[model samples]
Target: MSNTPSPTPLAPRRTVVAIAAILALGALAAVLILRSGTPGGSGAEAAHGHGHSEAAGHADGEHHGAAASAHAHDEAHADGEHHEGGGAPAARKSEAGHDEDEGLIAMDAQRMETAGIRLAEAGPATVRSVLQLPGEIRFNEDRTAHVVPRVAGVAESVAANLGQNVKKGQLLAVLSSAAVSEQRSELLAAQKRLSLARTTYAREKQLWEEKVSAEQDYLQARQALGEAEIAVSNAQQKLAATGASAGGAGGLNRFELRAPFDGVVVEKHLAVGEAVQDTTQVFTISDLRSVWAEMRVAAPDLPAVRVGEKATVRATAFDSSATGEVAYVGALIGQDTRTAPARITLPNPDGVWRPGLFVNVELTASSRQAALAVATSAIQRMEGQQAVVFVPVQGGFRARPVRVGRSDAKATEVLEGLQPGQPYVAEGSFVLKAELGKASAEHTH
Candidate 1:
């Protein structure tokens, strides 16, 4: 080997190799520092290393290959996670946006007016606790009459038909009866006898006064006249008691059945030429200007029902309604239904309340003062959940769930979820609910 002063070619080659290895290490360190400083710098760094590894020694190449493989694995995992988990965040963001847009009904004053959407404020009110009972319209028993002939008779003519309106004392039917004829005939005979007795008595009294007849003869004549008068009076009463005229154009046997009062004939069992007994109900007449709304009150509700309590009767078959008082209440309960019968007398001047019409009898069991109440029409049902009221907000109305208590025909008691003086939809609440449904459906799509 040459001295230190001589030229050293091998040494220079060794120096070159060392320098290359040093440069490779430096580059690798630089890549690691860049990757650490900027997490997204790995992709460019990996590409640069891939090309440089070809020129570097095998040892450097192997190291670069390991680093690049590790980098690729990390990149692949990150990319996969980004692709899979990225959808979750985006989906979550979209759902959040939809959630914020739900249950919002936008309406203006003009739209509300056109839709008949009226608004009212929730405030203190008297809520009547109403007890609804099923009932039926019936003939008022006090105004109904069952007509019967006083004597067995053959009906000569039925002047009145079913459902005929008649005045008091109007002839309903004419009947022929042998029993009635006998009474009238007896009266005629007694009257003839009385006429003769009266003349004889007058002569006797005059003769007695003139002393032209014996006193005993006069007394006997007077007694005979008195007895005849009694007999005639008895005959007249017998004919009158049977509701028969002593004499008629038709015949003495003709008996007239007349209406007791002004009424409508609801039922007729007698017809021309029909034989009827004394107790037969020939007709049923009723004054239909008033009717009875009868209901069966459960034993538990009996205490609340009284003879004079005001009641609202609503027809079930139609939209007819009337107000009445509880005219009567049964003292006894029905064994089968465990209820007592109650009656409400209603004025039906129009005759619209026909018998056998089903109805609902609403009675105010009690009245309570509520801190918050609203019109019953304000309540709306959403998805079969608890009732909700549309409360006015800054822009529109918001559905507010509420717990309800007592309710009446016009107002409802709001137990919760409402503030006094808060405006709410007192009418046309159903329109808001429909609009909300449409909005929700569109968001889903």
Candidate 2:
């Protein structure tokens, strides 16, 4: 009021400047508030108006800053939680994929793809009645021979060796014997006497007929000739029995041993320069063209085999076979084996059927009609009293009990529980059986 001389212009300028500065500070604070993410409200302006309120404004700004900081922290925590939650699904999916891969690996390791199975149909089949018998090939006794010395002698030379084929009357050995020489000498002496007696008898007969001499002299000559003839006949008969020739080196000691039959020399006991006895078997000869197969037939199977029955014989050593007919059936059973002896006459043209060869014999017992039959492998043992077979079904096999009739080593005749043309498992039936076994075992466990 006193001397303040019209300060209007400068006051206006000062007011303007103060207002501009305040406006500028307000603009900067607005920018800072925007950067700080502070909420705009009318309560903030009232808080900044007075000096006492300035303190409250600052306190309010601090409170807003602390709330903004807390909100930002909460957002960061939420983002981290979201990221962790998003990763959980991918991790779970990865673990699930690994599990699936493991499952595939496990499945591939078992090698269950190579198994095979077969099925068959039940139908009418011609089942042969097969009789199995243990047999042995033997030499035909009638066609074989044992060469024995007829007289005691020393063996000079043996012409036949073991397993040598010989014909009838072929020389087998040569023997030297004193007894043969003595018999030959006696024969020669008898023959000489007989020749002289024959001449004298002829002269006596002529004299008697012409009446050129006395009756007593002629009768004495005839009687002497008759006695000499009788002695000669006896000596000749003795030499002939000893297998000696009539005129070969009179009184010779050499004897020729001949084969009695046409056969192979299976055994040779005499050698060159070996002593032989009258009872010694010098050679054994067997006819290999025909052999005998001796088969042991059980008592139960005896009726099926008879004389003249056909049989087949097989041996392990030879691939060839022998066909024959039953030669004889023993009336008595063997004491040890409880079997009857059946002999078959086998044709051994190739000499393959040797004696003492172990063989398997198949005898045709009897033939009958069968409506249905199957391989023996199709039938499996089931319970204690019976058996069964698996018939094919929709998804599996149906176990069917069957009544079996006559069964050979190859096939079995179906008596019941099967029909013609019904499909069944013929091979690889053990798989189904094992499945059922496993099921039963699991149940029991």
All-Cα superposition RMSD per candidate: 6.5, 18.3
Candidate 1 per-residue C-alpha lDDT over 1-445 given as tens digits, one digit per residue, 9 for 90 to 100: 8567866555555444444544554455454554456664665566566635543443432444544545665566567557766687899998997776668788889998988998899999998888999999999999999999989999989999999999999999999899988898899999999999999999999999999999998999999999999999999898878778777567878899999999999999988999999999999999999999999999889988998999999998889899999999999998898989999999999999999999999998888998889999998888877699998876777899999888887899998998888889999999999998898788779
True-structure lDDT of candidate 1: 0.85
Per-candidate TM equals 0.79, 0.59
lDDT of model number 2 = 0.74
Q: After superposition, how far is residue 322 of candidate 1 from its true place, in Å?
A: 0.8
Model 1 misplaced regions, further than 4 Å: 1-100
Compared with the true structure, all predictions reach lDDT values of 0.85, 0.74
The best candidate in terms of lDDT: 1
